[model samples]
Target: KVLRLWLFCQNVSFMAAGVAVVAILAYPDGAMAYNHTPFICLVVLINVCGALGSLSTLAGTILIEREWAVVISEGEHPSFLAKMNSILRRIDLSCKLLAPVVTGFIISFVSLVASAVTLALWNILSVILQYWLLMSVYNGIPVLSRRGRFADESERVGFVSLESYSGWMNGLVDHPYVSAWRLYLKQDVVIPGVALALLYFTVLSFGTLMTATLEWEGVPTFVIGLGRGLSAVIGIGATFSYPVLESRISSLRAGLWSIWSQWSCLLLCMGSIWVKERVSSAYMLMGGVAASRLGLWMFDLAVIQQMQ
Candidate 1:
């Protein structure tokens, strides 16, 4: 239960920290008016915030999903899990589409700081929602809150020291995080899956570079955000199409499509490196950005299908 609470807190805190970084980055003129050092630091801080938020959300969500998987499984309902999973994917895609475009519109029409403030307020609202849902669902109590769990048995487990707790958690090497890495090392199929993961994210790393380069180039924030948002909109179909793909083809086979799609489409943007015109280069970059995202979402679907 402590672990669960810690995860949830980290989840909220990560998001809060991320938005705070955005607040720092809401420079109206694109690049900061000050020295490059502060700008670089803020950029690095935002990247850190993004990584932390993503990892924490991934870990917490995976933990919760496994709990749900136990209670609601294919054994009980044939298509229920798949249907719910597809629905969740749709919701996630919808958010992805909405957030950026909305942010773009705000930054276009309003002050940069206003956009940040809006995001911050939304996150605060989420914190409240998160608290409400948790409290209602579990009575805001630990899982092992029953009398027996707190009973004065021979091995009383009421409280534990920090060091003891750390040791205990470390003892659970079979935990998902640990086991996943172990499986990746021991299993041959997992290597290609990992490679696929690497390839997809590596391509999408360009998205970060694209953001920085474009911001540096003085591209309007709204245009940059809109282009990225539209690309995500285009990729939604690809994301939701994975289940149907699994029905028709083997997951392993389908996963290869993830790799093939991006590498192929990205070829169109190869000339961006050599192009001198800022406008042409900007178009090329947008093409690469969109193509990169399209492949990534498909890779996400393939990963869950085959790797998991």
Candidate 2:
């Protein structure tokens, strides 16, 4: 019930923000000129919206993918959980590839105002659909309603009086966010988790910087999008390969192999640094990143499964 209510609020917040942003930007004189008051306000508003959207996305993913997934697969075999995770990741990757392409197409062919209006309408519809789907899932799964609240109730600490503040400090230290990090740090799997997290910080991937750099080096937009699609497809292949590898070797061994393979493939990116030709270097970098997705996803699956 808490998760459902939170999701409902998230959808409402997202929809309201989306509508407001669209309305502001779609106004006749809403050009974001440098010295305009409205432009400054709009910039601040956009940042707020971005922060809200990011928070909502992270919360939703944790609630649905981590908590609800575990509840749904409570009594099922391990493979069931693996399959669910794979499906979730595949859908996420597909969206990552498709959303940008579709948005780009709309922005290129249609007016900016048209794209904004389209997105505003889509957000409204998506809010309704998302709430309906969440409610349906909640109704179908009785255990989910009882899952998170009761298990660790005793561990929740109360605050102390203002004089000493010891209890307050303890409560802060024992808060779920802090406690989660503490627990994670204590676990053997922390190494792999850190390794996975580090992947996000690198520019070797086909991220925004890399994409812009490739384009500046004469690679076409279509080629960059094609590379992104291919990378996603290769990443999806990890779902199939992971089970086989884990069955042959242990999960930890599979993870080790996967991470090493990713590192090895990244040698192409390193080699790109020494290449004299700009276009050839860009292609080399892109190819390395695309090829690395296979091992990246494999390692991701391995670490996630291990953590679960």
Candidate 3:
């Protein structure tokens, strides 16, 4: 029931996002050339849509990939879980690499309006296919359907619960969202989760900051895109390598290896900071960031399997 409700909400949100994007591009003159009020309103609407899409994606990932994977792999050997996790990561990375290239090609050659239309259409159409796929998976897997409710009666509470709080301070601490964080913090896997998050926070990847910095240093767009593509390739390689390494050494050791390898590659980036030459520093920074993806992804896979 929860899954169905979430899926329904995501479908509505995706369609709304599509409509908002189309509306933005429908202007006769470009947004900046025309009145600012409508432009601001459209921007806010799209931002909200994007946020909702992100949340929906996150929720769907947790539901299908993490929870369902565990349910299906129950009583199976750990390698089964590892394989499932790796395959999903591989597909995810592939899509991440391909989607941008495809979209960029369209935007560069076709038109921005066309690209917006394509995006809106994709959001509208893909939701139907995604819903079908998810439902089919649930139906096909008997164990998934057999799984009982995760939340206990004790876990359920109103958003504003007067009874649970004995004092004013208790109310703040005992808030449901706060309680969820408290429970997560107590888990053994929290360290691995933190490690994963730290990797995300790092600037070594092909993030917007590094891309802008490289461009500012007079690096060509082609080189930047090439470096980003290479990073994706390296990350894909990690997905392949993780299973073999895990079979030899356990997940924990694999994680250690991956993290150390990432740190070692990132040394180039640190060295770049000290370089006197601007262009050289940018290239060095880009190289370090690209190479680090290998370890970063392997470490990511290792952490996920550990959690599972």
Could you give candidate 3's per-residue lDDT for residues 1-308 as a string of tens digits? 86777776676676676677777778657656767888778778887877887787788788867888888889998888888888888888999899889989998999877877787687678777877898898889887877454656345533345566677777777666887776777678998899799779866678888888889999999999999899998888998999888988988999999999999999999999899999899899888888988899899989888777
lDDT of 1 by residue, 114-187 (tens): 78777667766776776677556555444523345324422332223335446658566536566556645665
- Among these predictions, the greatest lDDT belongs to 3
Clashing pairs in 1: none
Better of 2 and 3 by TM-score: 3
1-308 in candidate 2: lDDT tens per residue?
55656665565565656666676766557354544776567657666766776687788887777778888988897777777877888878878778877878888998666676676677678877888888899889898777455456335433223355467786777577876666567777888788889987788777889888899999998889898888888887887788778877867888899999999999999999999999899889888999999899989988888877
Q: Which ten residues in a row have the lowest lDDT in candidate 2?
A: 153-162
- Candidate 2 segments exceeding 4 Å error: 5-35, 148-176
lDDT of each: 0.62, 0.78, 0.82
The predicted structure with the larger TM-score, 1 or 3, is 3
TM-score of 2: 0.85
TM-score between candidate 1 and the true structure: 0.65
Ranking by TM-score: 3, 2, 1
Worst lDDT window (10 residues) for model 3? 153-162
User: Candidate 2, after superposition: displacement of residue 265 in Å?
Assistant: 1.3
Worst 10 residues of 1 by lDDT: 150-159
Q: List the residue pairs that clash in candidate 3.
A: none
